[model samples]
Target: MENKTNNYSYLRFAQEGKECIYDLFDAFLKKTIIEDRAIDFSKSMTVGDDGSIEFVTLEKDGAEVAFSELVGGDPSYKSVFELYLRRKACKAKDQLTARLALACAHLHWLWSLGMDCKTSCGMYGEAISVEEHWMDSLEDYNRESGLWHVNLSEAGVKQDLTLVFAIFHRFVTWPTRPQFKSVNQVKTALVEFVFKSKKNSGAPVRNGLLHLCDPDKYINWYSFESKTMFVTFHSEYLRGYKVSDYSELLAQDSLYYTRKYPKGMKLDPYQANRTEEKICYIFDRMEDNMPA
Candidate 1:
């Protein structure tokens, strides 16, 4: 933070091998002891053209919904899966609790990473509630003495996910082990939460790309046939943050939270480089896997 050297400490807790999208999916299939009263996730799920998940709901009419409907655009496998898991959680009572707990863990991640930055910018983003979603007091009601104009504030961009979690916790207290009644459930939820909560949109830079999972599927990047390499966050909100746009990234500590496992879980230069390589590889692979 103070060094202004782009320490990139956020990489310390990123998603890596065995924790990647594919790996996480495998684990979810193997684990997840909860009884799926709604949809049996054991059934193979496919990705939509827009990268949304083509999943079916077992509710009342058993209607179907795609990941794109809920998740913005060009959804990543990570975000796609998280959304799917959350939907499944809705089917059962226990999983719903676990998902909420995992949300709290995700909030902790946002808070912890910003603090790790230890920079003035980090402090600023952490302190300020970027998107404060609350009722406009005047919009509440009307009085005999005066007329009340009610206006519900929309959810604008927030600097950090911590702020979102703060408000959310107010209604559904932070997820706790005791409350969940199972450590395994909390642990699983934490994995999904951590995996999906990283800042995927910050790759070539920083901005609204926060809360992304894997950019390979979610993001769009330009390949250079003439000169230098260029990466871009394709989201309408994130594209605004240009390269080296420090202010916008005051809260976003890492391009993506891809971790180095079985090695003390430290965020270092090697891991940073590894993360870059993975992204590069994904884009490269896109050439072959991309639609015709």
Candidate 2:
């Protein structure tokens, strides 16, 4: 019965989650004051043939920054929304939910910023290559009647929620424009997609911090046992500093470990990973450094 209740709660959460996201977007649109100098940041952006948004960085004052950071760095909408969500989540003692909420807020903030911003429905591109372990051999013990059979871990299971979260964040925050979907539709789709992704994963199992090579291939390298997973993240502008750079930093810092994993297994998903928090913190810091 407890399991049933949790299932139902999540179902309801998904449904209402869409509404919550839509409401936030609506509020942002109504409340934000557009800056005259605000670049039509949505220009040149495409949602792609697939569902993924093609994020490209723009040059401002000789610095290149992605749309995510640009919208996030905006003083008027993005910063305020992030600050509010941080406080609200802290007050409720639900940081995970809070982070999710902030991600949604970021989407709304982006959407409100301009119409040129758009979203797509598929993957951006390929992932950086790395050495991956393959099961070269498997012992057959069924004939001996001493042990059961073994199987390679299933492929296509998305263990990382961060990429999903980040993608949804970008979708929701997409600026209102001629090509974009209605805010309500975007919100509903995000909630529905998240629920579907979770449901398809078979069970409510949480894997440790997951980063995507693409939406289909995810790498889970941060573990108490493995301690680190080497990966290369795609960047439009910079070749050296990729998403994996951030992951490497988190792995080195003992303070970032969740301490929720057993002695052997990876950390629990429910426990807060510092990587996501660090991303948000960096955004906040950037906002602070910008001239007022």
Candidate 3:
């Protein structure tokens, strides 16, 4: 029922999604180094410029090992880990080294399970995606659904195995931090709060990258006719911005409110928030129409 071959080669790749070297390290961080069987995560981090974290030391059973040396022991993870260190060592767009590695890894794990993984590259603060923007940019030359190309098509298989796991981690996992009970709730919050903002109509703006706009400064441009952006994020864009900025926005608000209603009086007790989405995994493949 499960393919636990090659020390779970396929499953590990699917779990981490090659988002970056950090993600790969993260998997082991959850498993080897920090996982209870051998490594415990009672480690210290030394922060570098721009909030970057460097693993300093790991303590276990009163034994301390240099973090870098501990990582070098694993051949599978060690290779890429070395590369990440080299990138940091050279200072090449050094701040974005992590981001680019995450991007380059892309969604290979998702692709492995036979899904058309769509990705778009843009500036740092840009919206990585907006379905509205993607659809509007179709050119006339295309036929059949007006899609430009077929990227992940090798034919799909209806193979289900126990150890194999996959997911759309960001879209699915993000709602968790925001406290939404389900993905649908996240969708509802987006539709009610963001999609209808500033025009209440889904007006398509090319380069619709969600640059953060202060509600007070851009009220005329950001405000929906009747609804206010009550949540931390502005209308459609999800972001984790600077503390000073977030703090300022919250203080200026008659927008965000707190209600002391009894437990069941609330709107399903579903809260919403967003965090930086680093990985997306595809846990299953059950159809033959698509390709991997």
Candidate 4:
């Protein structure tokens, strides 16, 4: 019996070590794939047939976890992992993941347009990770450690992205969720904790971050004037639209993961220019018809 117990322990150790090795190899392959398919700056980025912005994704055996069993079904934890996996595996089905993909796609598009400095800032904000490398952060995440002690020793102010990174780190490493229940609540709390003063907060940048977290509940208009225009010219669209800053809506999100259709996140580069053209068309018509 003693010898059998020793053998079992040895086997378990060996298996864990083997898994660690596999994870390292997987990371190497993913990096190689991304490098091999590096976007040629001389050529324009294109959209995929699925209507998502073309971004690199690891084409590996997709893994599925029931929504109920995901990160123990903790809404906050689930959201962080969802974004991470969606980016890593191109899987995004839930509201948060979907919005993240959309926001990143739009931000990337804006980057391509050189619309303004904010476009470039927002793009880097979404792309950055908290560690020397993103996979390092994933590997360093220890649930036993709390937010203050997570693997953010290398963290920096990534413009508005500082808030996004802080949120991701908090959700993934924090042992427990804060009392907040909504995505904005999480954002607001993180903003207070991460930014030293309100002066550092830019409305479009911060609000855009909020929209990325929950598109149904928040709009990603780049300016307050744009939001006002949408409200003034399209009041009926927002008549009953009470933006709730909570996670209750996450329950209604369409979520299913399979090998064929993993999470549904996308990041495209040219989408911003197209969206801008449509907005300009609307403005042109409004200018001709509406009183200033």
Q: Highest lDDT, which number?
A: 4
Per-residue lDDT for 1-292 in model 3, tens only? 1111112223322222222222222332233223212222223323334333333333445875332332223334433433543342422254344332322222222122122233221121132221112212222211122111223243221111100111111122233335545323433343323222232222211001010111111111111211122222232232332333465444534332222225553322111111111110111111222476
Assess candidate 1 and give its TM-score to the true structure: 0.19
Taken over the whole model, the C-alpha lDDT of each candidate is: 0.28, 0.28, 0.24, 0.31
Candidate 2 vs 4: which has more lDDT: 4
Model 4: lowest-lDDT 10 consecutive positions: 1-10
Tell me the deviation in Å of residue 62 in model 4. 20
Selected candidate, larger lDDT, 1 vs 4: 4
Q: Specify the poorest-scoring 10-residue window by lDDT in model 2.
A: 121-130
Residues 20-139, candidate 2, lDDT per residue (tens digit)? 222222333222212111222233323323322222233456864233432333335534443543442322235433333433433333322211122211111001111111101112
Measured on C-alpha atoms, candidate 1 has an lDDT of 0.28
Error of 4 at 47 (Å): 9.6
Q: Candidate 2: misplaced stretches above 4 Å?
A: 1-79, 86-209, 214-255, 261-292
**Model 3 Cα displacement at 218 (Å)?**
26
Q: Estimate, for each residue in 46-114, the C-alpha lDDT of model 4 and write its tens digit.
A: 333432222233221363212112123345753464345344443345655543443343223322221
**Candidate 1: misplaced stretches above 4 Å?**
1-60, 66-268, 274-292
Q: Where is model 4 more than 4 Å wrong at Cα?
A: 1-158, 177-203, 224-292
